[model samples]
Target chain A: MIKVQQEDFDVSAELAALAAGNHGIGGIVSFVGLVRDLVGPDNAEPALRAMTLEHYPAMTEKKLGDIEAQANARWPLEASLIIHRYGRLEPGAQIVLVACAAAHRQDAFDSCNFLMDWLKTEAPFWKLEETEAGEDWVDSRASDDAAAARWQAKPDRAAE
Target chain B: MKILYFAWLRQRIGVAAEEFDLPADVTTIDDLVGYLTAKGPGYAKGFAEPQVIRAAVNYEYVPFDHKLSNNDEVAFFPPVTGG
Candidate 1:
């Protein structure tokens, strides 16, 4: 499970579905990324009014599927879900959600981190935020690259 | 043919999508980038540093050496930045 949508999702409902199938599973880890009110120039204190997210439609889904496949290969996840939104979103809006269910806490935690890291660095999505200052396009952050690099260097996984 | 730009590529190219005829020798991503560079200053700047740029054809990520054909959708952009 990978979904890219434009509507807000119910995190609790998604977690329930992810957790329902595995009676043996002992842990479920979920991550929800929210749109922040502040982005861009620090001194200017930009108030993000809306965000428009663009993606390579067919390619985006494929890349996300690949990420899930990799996680499945590494861990014993009973189920997983990834939901991402597009179009204009307001501050405090949920942008993405990732949930992992595994037999142990370690697998769930590691898989969730791995998915989020890969998505941040490799997923094809562009964000444009309309702020008080003006419309500012978000840049690929160096920090995100570092986060992804950590997983890319995992001895068990091939280089991405 | 459709030409698509995403992320910083859209910022540099000044548009999300555009259309153009397939040029005679433009059969690879590199050739297309060169052709785009010749279009104007913005294009040249957009592709100023080609090493940092990546491309995809018809929604599949491909290297600069990837071959292309008529009516294909070609995209140019910086490394993906998403989460």
Candidate 2:
């Protein structure tokens, strides 16, 4: 499942839904993102008042589907879910959730990590931090690009 | 053609999306950036740093060298910052 919504979600309910009846899944790994009250490098600058997520409606969904497809192509996944929230949200509010289920812990763990890494660089969603100093669009980090780049070598190494 | 902007580009361009009558000379995403830069400083500023800017055609990521069609849906945005 891939969702881009303004409303908050129930993580437990969503995870359970992912693993509903199929007993073949041995494990599930998940990651949830949250808005922070402090923003910037080292998360030490600007006190965040709120966060507003902006995204291209149709394009966001299309890109997410592509990301999910890539994960499935790379791993033996039983199920996966990605939920990203938009609109105004307070600090500490849930912003995104990613869960992956597979027949083993390694696949579930690695695929879950790969899903988040790709989403960080490929997803169309953008974060606008509203702080007492004023609102600013969050800048992209090189660290994220590097994180996603690691997977580029994985397929080649696996084949070798 | 429908052209869209997001993140800081949208903020600087002062519009989320717009219909544009693309010129024949503007054949690719790179050319389109030049055309938009000529619109005004707001657009110029938005596209000033070509390296950090990203483009999509019909909702798929593409290079600046990717060719454009008159009816294509084009979008320019900054590097994504979402997780």
Q: What TM-score fits each model?
A: 0.87, 0.95
Question: Mind sharing the TM-score for model 2?
Answer: 0.95
**Candidate 2 at residue B70, lDDT?**
86
Which lDDT tens digits does candidate 1 get at residues A18-108?
8885798788999999888775666567577988888888789988999999999988888999998888888989999999998888889
DockQ of each: 0.64, 0.87
**C-alpha positional error of residue B45 in candidate 2 after TM-score superposition, expressed in Å:** 1.7
Per-residue lDDT over B18-54 for candidate 1, one digit per residue giving the tens place of the 0 to 100 score: 9888989888999888989999887888899998888
Scored by Cα lDDT, where does model 2 land?
A: 0.90
Which candidate achieves the best TM-score against the true structure? 2
Runs with alpha carbons beyond 4 Å of true place in candidate 1 = A39-44, A156-160, B11-15, B18-21, B40-42
What TM value does model 1 have?
0.87
lDDT of 2 by residue, B30-66 (tens): 9999999999989989988988899999999999999
